[model samples]
Target: MKNRHTPCTECRKQRRKCIQISPDQPCLRCQKLDKICARPENCALDPNNEVECLNQEVNELNQAIQRMEHELKTLGIKSPLYIKNNTMTLPRSTIENLFYNWKIKINNGYFTIDTGIKYISDLLPHYTSIEYLSPMTSYSSSSSEDSWSDGGSILIRFKSQEYGGFYGLTGKMLTKWIKKRMLGQQALLINHIPCGSRMLLDRLVDIYFNCHNLYCGWLHESSFRKRYSQLKEPLDDLICASLCCYVCATPCDHLDFNAYQRRDMCDYFYLKAKEKLVDQFDEPDKRLENICLDLRSEYEAAKVQTGIDYALFARHFSVAYCLRITLDCVVNKPITRQPIPFPVMNTLPDELEETKDFIRVMTWVNHLYEEPFVDMLVEQIHLILIGSTCTISFETVARMDQFLLDFGKNIPSEWRLCDNVFDEAKCRKALDQTTNPVAIHAFLHFAVLIVILYVTILQPVSVNDENDLLLQHIQRNALEKSLKMSRLLLYGVQRLFKLKTLSPCHVKLTSMIIMLYLVDPIVLQCSSPIKSSVLEAQKMFQKCLDIICNIRGIQREDTPPQLLAEKKDIKDFIHNGSVDIDYYDRFPDPWCALLHDVSQFFI
Candidate 1:
């Protein structure tokens, strides 16, 4: 009697001899009868081969268990009990113990179970494997007739639920913990200020109102002056620091005397302000709100004369100040330092209100004032702010580009070129004669907006191989043209800063330009001409940085880590004739993060 492979299921049920040409195909009899056919259980090439296949499968399973145990040992974790359950009993107690250990180790920082949970959940079979398991006498006492497959059914169900629950719970709890920690570690609001004179205080406050307050107008001149007079001997450092920031932002002609005196006074006040803002006030937000209220009252009184809407001005200014205060509080703080609870986070809804007010005021400015420069400046600021903060779609980008292009046509030729260096005397003379005293101010504002637009818009455009080469060439040419225009705009900014004609806003703007010079995709491309242009732009930027650092007493080396990192890359390129352009390519938009970081330096 000869042994043979098992017959197909249909053939076996019928107790008929099955004839087949291939192992995987239907038997000849079943195919002829047009019946569905499947291979019989325990079927193989031969009796010995079936056992050999089972041994190989068991060996592979053991090897996998050993590998998992080795990995567990490497991570300093004890091997799980399931690895040793070769009999497939998978005890319910062992499964529970494994989960409990995982929970403990997860909290102990031994492992991050969230990723593991996701991995396990993804690897699990969609349907339960209980039906496939061999029947066992251990669970035979259960009431259900199909419930005698050991603990595999219970273990599978528990694993599915446990992993999903743990992933969700851990994520929520971790986020809650982080937010709570941030609230506890709020940055100090104010520090002590060195003693100063009433005259110097008055001068600083005047500068603050004239330069910083012109755009922000968060502080009213009359109310600020009255407060200055009412306060006894030494003024509060918060007020004093705010005053210093004002003077630091003021141009030379805005000062009564010489540039040297102006710079010296600005520096003195800046340090005092930083010390007070960083060290003194425990509840900076409350103090800042009080200050803004006083200014708001003043803004209401002079709203008719200033031709600026109080609600719009106050909201925008307050947001800027809030950001400024937050940045100052964390400036010298470490990145891994306890999170500082942002007071402004609660007031974020006010930003929407501010946006609405801006649109309303902008309509008034355009319709009533009919001032193109003012309209353009407001529009540019609106677009830049929106673009920087939001997730813009392709349609929004296209619309914004069209809007800017239309506005660009109206930009004064002098604004496009760096033909005239910003001269305080010349600026004052021009303002004194012209009907629009705010022309230079508007131009400076426009310059800052252009730099922002460059960072947020132009630099990010790419040319793909699938695109028409001619179209690509056209885009590259346009990019080169825009890069030149950006450099020229930056040149105007540097001149303004050099002459002390711009505000602290220019410091933020120049810092952004420096960032762009470092990582702008066009500049960072592996091309000589573009790289040389970037280096030239850096020299101009260094001048701007020097002037800002001189007033703020911040050294170039003391700049933010992101900027410093870019500087090193540039240095490496200059020395070794190579730079890691790919490092910058990793960023979605490298300048976006840089802009965000630099914006903190301002309001």
Candidate 2:
């Protein structure tokens, strides 16, 4: 209402350089910001009021600076960086190396920083080359052959089964690596199985790498700070490749492999499966030699195509394979006993098979560990528990209840929310649940370590039985193994509970077990169970009978038909403790809960 006053709408709400809307219809700043212009009362803001407020702010800021200066003067201290020498003097870094341990943070598993970085970098141009790329340059090269080479044995020999070294000089690394190497030689074996069995290895790799597409949105640290989408074409492709790589894992033997039971490998069929999988790859990426070339920046137009999602592939493959493996181990060696010793590398002092029983519990817990399901189920639970506005169906609740039965014993999870939720206790419980996806991963890994320890520590003593020292050493090694893993388990549990996303319930479970283990290793060992074995002879015998019975001649050179009945005898001999369904029914609720828990937490 004051004379010569600008309208509040134009001045503050519109943020325009306004004299008065009555004087001029258009506001200047509105045009600059490309916003719509309107009458003064269009907004609740008053321009004169805003000006006064701003002036007060300016005064406050000045006073704050003055106060800060006076405090600094009294203390005889200026800014924290107030050195007499204005010139910069970079001090020698105490840290030997400053490298980001940038790992691909997948829910169920993690990749080594070095492995992930190297693998992803392979898809992108060299750091130096990326710096030189101009928008004018093209990125026409989109061939695996142009990417990396058919490093003939590198994939199998280095990355595949003998995969223990995938993380660190981990105990599992040396052993698994060797195992895979041996398996890759299916051609030479007396009985050949699939070399890359189930093609899970590659699929896991593909899936993780493919997830890089999501990375394009991530802000970079540099000047442009561009999202992944803003990057040139090839870079995008490389990112896609990284995401896909995570998906591609080596598939394991199928559970239904009973129908296609393998017999003695005659060095012929062994070559077939290996060749078939390889031919599928057709043109192998033989860029191994020229992988160092930085030509992408110089040629090809900047056009890109989305790559694969190898992580998804690998995840699926892993789920199937791991399930198959779990079944194999359990089927081959069932734990009929009540209490099991936690598994030790060599042999425990007294009854270490008890340890293996604990591992059996871990296996049970694992069946529930499906990555995709966890996130979705967690979401529903969150909505039901926390969001009064949302209503979840009884059917959904039942399913979720079943999920809880399987894997929720120790995990504290959120009811509902989006983005960046970390429950350390739940994560710890997830890690400890034995049925966790990574536990199986670490299982295969620990197997390698056992193999190494056997080879390095136990094997030598067993082999060079010099003065009864071997058994003693083996016992000592076994004790150390149990203690070491127990410690890792304890640490993993503690760290897991601290996560923000975990619930108090999971923390309690983790703490309960942690308390037991911390209180007494002997008690934990007594309660723990043994790990199941991985090879089943029942299917083997059944298939062997089928093949022999199918023979035309009464006595063929390949396999004697007379031995068909003998095969059942062998099967009966191996599966001595096989019991009735009532045996499973007899299990109490807690055990039932454990089973359900595993089904949910593990895939």
lDDT string, candidate 2, 103-131, tens digits: 33322122223434323214232332322
Error (Å) of candidate 2 at residue 475 is 3.3
lDDT of 2 at 229: 35
- Please provide, for model 1 over 1-603, each residue's C-alpha lDDT reduced to its tens digit, 9 standing for 90 to 100: 235568888778766778888877888877866888887576746746656766676666668769977775544323233333234455576556444644322221123334233322232332123311313223235455233222333211101111111112222333443454321111212223222667666666665655445543355455556666777754454765666655554443344533434434444556556656544322457667757755653443432423233444534544554344223322311112111221111122323333333233333222312333323333322222222111222333334445545454454443322223223344334434433213333444444344433333332322354434433443354345445545544444444444443455534534443433333322222222355554654454444344444433333443345744663323333323333334432333332322233323221
Model 1 CA deviation exceeding 4 Å by range: 1-194, 206-218, 245-400, 407-437, 455-478, 487-603
List lDDT for all candidates, in order.
0.41, 0.30
lDDT of 2: 0.30
lDDT of 1 at 500: 42
Q: In order, how many clashes per candidate? A: 12, 125
lDDT of 2 at 7: 48
TM-score top scorer: 1
Could you tell me which 10 consecutive residues in candidate 1 have the lowest summed lDDT? 157-166
